[model samples]
Target: MREISLDRLRTLVAIADHGSFAEAARVLNLAPPTVSLHIADLEERVGGLLLSRTRGRVQPSAIGETLIERARRLLADAEQALEDVERQVQGLAGRVRLGASTGVIAQLIPQALETLSQEHAGIDVQVAVLTSQQTLQKLADGSLDIGVIALPQSPVKGLKIKPWRRDPVMAFLPARWACPDIISPAWLAAQPLILNDNSTRLSRQVGEWFATEGPQPTPRIQLNYNDAIKSLVAAGYGATVLPHEASTPAPESRIVMRPLQPSLWRELGIAHRAGEVERSTRHVLEVLWELEAL
Candidate 1:
């Protein structure tokens, strides 16, 4: 079967966009007869009438509509292919897909990305909010380039894991409510607690902290988002154990954050597939490393 010409496809799209073959020819810098012939060739190849002309305006027929949609995709793909080639030749523009947990995304990723943008304006970073386990799985599956995740994860074959940062877990309470200077697990467990759900590694750590003192206290609410948990705490609904970064003070905020007595900390790390890294991924890693040093 004969393949459709991109030029002819472009002509069809132009005519549809401008609502007339003459207008399309003007925009495309092609003669009106040339544009008409291009459409004729496309229709013959497609084995259907591709357009309907009324007065001076033109509209696509049903088959034309289908081919027009496909044609747009083909054109877009062609353009993207060209752009990718150009970016490769330029040696600085590329896309990197990075995965991390919600807390990392909120607290650290933005600053890292800000540094990345300053250093490499042409590089594009795409972020996915995923659990550490999910991030590891994606990295192994080649879906993600880099992942910022909670460390001390169960060993995964062929992954490069390096410690990133440590953040202290703090007890959050309403500022107006009476609370001790430093919160103990027993004290925290006795309150109406809004805890991180079991899906997060932090939740498991918190659970273990509670388990050390016999029976675990059930939470009044289990939530994943720190911001949402803080909102509830600020409203005097209940208290929560979350990262210290989550408790960043807002002006005249209703919430107060107190350190845990036997300070519990969450360890985060970066993971990537164990192999030769691509230039863009390496660039991102370099930026992250520099940020880590600072």
Candidate 2:
């Protein structure tokens, strides 16, 4: 049998993903007839049917299913090899996919990306906003090159986990509500609360604190974005808690942050798949450690 062509493999993958020859043609910028012809050619080369077409939908045959799995790996390895070559020639010139939870994306990631861009212009960094759970899933699937996640206990298999920094959680209070000095649990309890969304690691920590400090603390509002929560606090709607770096007071000083008596902190770390490490991923991790130090 003749070796199957890369074009044929790509068309097969595209059809499998789109579930229709017309849709695959649109994706690959080919005529629908051309796409059908490619698949026919591929099937003849392999001496088996690859797809079963009904009226509107398409399903891969058993042989097609097995070949699809192999095709995906081939495509992935091909892309990685290209990236590896670029890395060798250009220091760190390739796509690096990174994810971070919502709050960290606001302050931490922007600063880190700026520093990395300045030092290594060749590296192409793409960031996705993910919850801690979603970040873990993507890392496990090799969809992400690295992630800045809240610390995890046992590292994912074939992945390197490194502690990056500890962020002190602080109260965001309206200027009118800002206490003169340190905020005790009682003081925090006194204000109307704008709490973090329940899924967040910071939210879980804050919930535990609330449970210990004052059970059933009433909430005036809830928000997901760090900036939106700060905006509400500044408007005197209610107070919210987040990491210090996640927010800051206005120059004229309408909002302020005060340390809680018991104090709260969250750990942030970098996770990357274990193997021949990608240059862009290493550059990102190094910048994170530098930021943590300062």
Candidate 3:
């Protein structure tokens, strides 16, 4: 019996993820032939074909599927072992890159980062601001260690999503807009508005809610930047809608956030590729989970 090498298993996982030798090679920082040779070696050692190749794409056969399942676990365990060793030597020293939707990054990430930094000064954190869709893609590509997103009821395969927190959508009214403290959708529509475009799940929730209320005019301004939308509303460019996190006061007297007479909110969660959890990432996730408890 041949002992499978971590290098070979890693190649298998990458090929399975990317669906092509060329792409997997790119991820592995190897020449395409090198990846092919490794997979061939792995297949020969296993004594069973592990993948089915079509025109250009590759997929796991039944045996390949079995191998992949085990491979992910093996790789995870191996990675964890490396992390544990490093922890002993360096004391939780490592870096993790995270992708976060615009809402959470803008509203909550700073505070959370400060908290993490206080506890684990050795763990370096890098965050990229991305839309939920982009975040999911980055996670799939292994470019991001974790993603914070708003997930739908149905889930994606090969990914693990954990609910982090609930965020409500609230109306941002001009500081001096003489409207009710909490306005109805109809009342909100009566004013000129700049809305966060329908590119995000939270924005779509607001759009659908408005659609259900009856016919309404399109927004005067369609914007993507959360802070810009808030600024516009404060400047009286128009009223805007934002998640409850954004609805919080800006500490300046110029903007006012009021709950909608009928309130709406979006649920947010942290997502990672399904498999062995990295020790460093697991520790960070524990911190987020604690935030939920708080």
Model 3 clashing residue pairs (backbone): none
- Candidate 2 residues lying further than 4 Å off, grouped into runs, are 1-84, 87-90, 178-180, 246-252
Candidate 3: count of backbone clashes, pairs at least 3 residues apart or interchain: 0
lDDT of 3 by residue, 1-294 (tens): 778888989999999999998999999999999998998998899888988888768989899999999999999999998986788355376777888866677777776777788887677778998988888888888898888888673586777888888766778887787868776788887789898777878777877777667675589988788788877887888988777654344524777878876778778888988998776777667667766633
**C-alpha lDDT of all candidate models, in order:** 0.86, 0.81, 0.80
Error of 2 at 100 (Å): 0.4
Compose the digit string of candidate 2's lDDT tens values, residues 171-255. Answer: 8788886374777666677778999778777778887877776775777877678888888888889887888763333322778
The C-alpha local distance difference test score for the whole of candidate 2 amounts to 0.81
TM-scores, each model vs. reference:
0.70, 0.68, 0.67
lDDT, model 3, position 207: 71
Where is model 1 poorest over a 10-residue stretch in terms of lDDT? Answer: 243-252
Kindly report which residue pairs in candidate 2 clash with one another: none
Total backbone clashes of model 2?
Answer: 0
Looking at model 1, the pairs that clash are none
- Candidate 3 vs. truth: CA RMSD? 16.0
